[model samples]
Target: MTGWDISPAGVQSVVSNVRDAADAMNSGITLYGKSVEGAMTSAGTLSFGTDGVGGDAAGLVALALAKFVEGTERDMAFLPLRASNSANGAVEATNAYISGSLEQAWNAQRQATRAPDVTAFLEAARKKAGEGR
Candidate 1:
C-alpha cells in the first residue's frame, strides 16, 4: 500500500504565489491596454501622403495594427481567470484533505474496486435463459 502526505501550509503558499502572479499580470495588461489606446488615438489622424497610393498604404497599416491589438487582447484576457481558478482549486482540495474527506473518498473508491463484473454476470444470465428456452 502506498501512503499519501500533504502539507496545508505548502498548498497555501502556492496559492498565495499564484494570486500574486495573477495580480502582477493583470496590472501589466492594464498598462499595456492604456498605452495601446493612447497610440491608437494618436495614429487616428496620421497621414502618409496626399496621394491615393500613400493613403491606401496608410489605411492598410492602420487596419493591420488594429487587428494585431485585437488578437493580443483576446489572447491575454483569460490569464487572470485561469490563475484564479487554479488557486481556488488548490484551496478547495486542501480543505478537503484537511477535513479527511479526501481520504474517505479514496477509501470508498478502493472498496468499489471489488465491484462485480457486469459482463460476466450478464453472460451467465443469458446462458441460463437460453437453456430454459
Candidate 2:
C-alpha cells in the first residue's frame, strides 16, 4: 500500500506567496501613482484602462489569479486529510498530479503577474508626458 503525504498547507503557501507578491506590486504601483501630484494624464489613464498593460486588464488578470487560487485551494482542501488517512496508491498519484498542476499554474501566473509589457509601459508614459494634462 503506497501512502501519499501531500500537505495542503504547503500548496497554499506556494500560491499565497505569489499572490502576496502580485498584491504588493499592484499596491505599490497604485500608491506611487497616487503620490504624484500630476503624474498621470488622460492618455496614460486611457492607455492603462484600455490597452493591455494596466488598469482594467490588470484587474482582470488579478481576478483570474484569484479564481485560480480559490479553485486550487478548494480542490486541495481535503488533500491533507486524505494524505494522512488514505493508503491507496491511486490517491498518491492523484495528489501528485494535482500538486504538480498547481505548481505549474503558479509558475505561469507569477510570470504573467510580475512581468508587464515594456513597450506598453513606454507608450503609456510617452503619451502621458506628451498630453500635458
Candidate 3:
C-alpha cells in the first residue's frame, strides 16, 4: 500500500484530459485548414457527412476482434499484425478524410453562392430603371 502513491480516480482524470487535448489538436488543425479552404472549402462547427475516422476506427476494432475471433492471418487493413494496430489510435484517417472532404465541398458551395454576376445585375437594374421606355 505504501508503494502505491496515486489513486485510481487520479489516473482516470489524467487519461481523460490527455484524450481531450488530442481531440482538440486534431480539431484545431481542421479549423486551420478550413480557413485556407475558405474559397475552396467551408468553415463551420459541425456538418452532415460521413465520419471516416470513426468508421475506420470501428473497422479497425472489428478487424482486431475478428482476427482474435477467427485466429486467422493479419489483413492489410489491420496492419502491423502483432503490435502495430493497438486499436488505441482512437481517431482513424478514414473518418477524418471523409469529414474534411465534405467540409471543403461545403465551403465551395458557399463561395459559389456568394459570387454575383455584375453584368447581369447591372442589366436588370438598367432595364428596371428604363421600364417606362
- Quick one: best TM-score, which candidate? 1
Q: Pick the candidate with the highest lDDT.
A: 1
Tens digits of lDDT, candidate 1, 15-132 = 8999999999989988987876666655654456678455523344456677888677545665676677667766765676677788654554444334344455546756998999
lDDT over C-alpha atoms for residue 98 of model 1:
70
Q: Candidates sorted by TM-score, descending order? A: 1, 2, 3
Candidate 1: clashing pairs of residues: none
**Weakest 10 consecutive residues, lDDT, candidate 1?**
108-117
lDDT of 3 by residue, 96-119 (tens): 334555444444434433434445
What does each candidate score in C-alpha RMSD?
Answer: 18.6, 17.7, 27.4
Better of 1 and 3 by TM-score: 1
Report the poorest 10 consecutive residues by lDDT, candidate 2: 37-46
TM-score of each: 0.61, 0.28, 0.26
lDDT of candidate 2 over 1-133, digit per residue (tens): 1243556566555555645655565565457445432332221322353456565333444445556644554333333323322222223334554666645544443443343344555567679989996
Quantify all predictions' global Cα lDDT against the true fold: 0.67, 0.45, 0.40
Name the runs in model 1 displaced over 4 angstroms.
Answer: 1-3, 46-62, 103-133
Residue 65 in candidate 2, Cα distance off native in Å: 33
